[model samples]
Target: MLDIRRLHMLKTVAARGSITAAAQSLALSAGAVSQQLAALRHDVGVDLLRPDGRTVALTEAGRVLLEHADRILAAMEEAECAVAAVKGTVGATATLAALPSTVARIVAPALTALGTDHPQLAVTCLVTDQAQLRELTLGTVDVVLGQRYHHVPETMPKGIAVSPLLDDPLLVVTAADGSDERSFGLRELATHHLVVPPATTDCGQAILHACRQAGFTPTTRYVTADIAAQLALARSGLATALVPRTAIDPATPGISAAPIEDHPIQRLLFAATRRTETTNPTTAAVIAALGTAARQDHTTYLPPA
Candidate 1:
């Protein structure tokens, strides 16, 4: 019989594209991962990988095995979840990866709700960037909280399930002491020194793309992914920023905020789960908690019509 653990290691190596990277992700040494792969190759009686200079390429047999490995691992995960469900047991760990924005606003409330309502289920949340989608698809994490820009939509990976949590609008942030009567228009915004997240980020891309659509490019003077830093700059008379409504802390002072007219840029905050793990009771509980927190956030922060 093929060793399940070794098969999983092979899958990780394949997903990561390198023995070293796979080892780091799995908390194993490169040598150890290599040994396991060698053992797995021997057991399968096939050449699963071939040397390609500093790296290795999956052999045809390796590709075939990888396909089966994904299914086998998913099936095993599903079986575990199913058995726990059938036993009516809720005590299990559900790992989640979330972007910084969601972590800032949604994680605490969601965790508190989970602790109160499903005490038996436990969660571990990681703050990550857009890379979490790959981890979710590989089953390294059970779920991911992510953002999708309306103008530049995120293409969902195959076999992942998404649940929308919030419709987050972008807000123009400037010094609270500045003219409250200042108008909002992408063209006007282009004239100012803009503070934005790194252009590589989805939020940053959304803001930049909207400005370009308005027939002008912003003069971005400050770039950082830290929401606090961006707001601080806006409050300090340094530059204006486009921020998500969900990322604003009500207690924070010194910043004036207004919704962009016509909603030129908006993002959908959503949670993604591996389709195979969708039935896991612990994962389901966590998703429910996230949904509840998001609903409350929208109610409290978003202006009522």
Candidate 2:
């Protein structure tokens, strides 16, 4: 079967005139350009180009192929635009990607509300972080719930639409049973065992920065990335950890979260759409519900750092 991508490549090469120029224009390796051109010639069963000293010029067959390719692609683009305007009342699929923590706490509730209201929409949740979430802005996934720390660069991907969904508090957690004092100063925490998040992660780095500001380094007992495991350690008297306040579950009833007196961390959450006029109706409905959930979620706001 003829490949559409190879046809597009042939069309591009013909328009650009030279293979070297086409490679540069397309940001593809010179070898890849040469291979695709050879494949395109074989696929069409014709000699498509003529060598003219250093540069190559398209023969009659190549010109004909280029014309056809351009017409086909333009027709496809028009079809996409036309169909995208239709409302998806019949049946549609929507995929939502979010961090593991956010998927459990925030996305689950929003998805529940959507499922109850819009029975035609099927929702699938994928666990991912901000970097992965940014990639889905290309329309790979219908909606993305991204979690970002305070100090991380305040950047939203261009060409994608976004809505702020929730603001979650990152807390300093310890054993509720062991500490008689409700609150502790910087000096008191320096003496305890800390199970810090991996130094590479945002949560771990934030806790490290707070300790440095307090004029001491935390003695880390374990280097772990899972906030749940860190919370478990803190509850079992193995170590104290910094975790999101919403992460505390009664099933793991040992750990207790207390807001830091010195530094309070708040995470920004955003819901994204590939484009405002996307074809997916389920995505549109989810976006509307998320806006409602975000406004209702405004029960308490943690102070920013």
Candidate 1: stretches off by over 4 Å: 178-183, 302-305
lDDT (Cα atoms) of all candidates against the true structure: 0.83, 0.68
TM-score top scorer: 1
Sliding window of 10 residues with minimal summed lDDT for model 1: 177-186
What would the per-residue lDDT of candidate 1 be over residues 136-215, giving only the tens digit for each residue?
A: 87777887888899997469887788899989988888888745434477677867898998888988988888988888
TM-score of 2: 0.66
The best candidate in terms of lDDT: 1
Give residue 301's lDDT in candidate 1 (0 to 100).
Answer: 76
lDDT of 1 at 98: 85
Worst 10 residues of 2 by lDDT: 296-305
Cα deviation of 251, candidate 2, in Å: 6.4
Model 2: pairs clashing at backbone N, Cα or C within 3 Å:
none
Candidate 2, residues 194-297: lDDT per residue as tens digits? 88878787677777776787789989989987877887788788888877654544345556666666656667777886653444455667877776666654
Score every model by TM-score: 0.93, 0.66
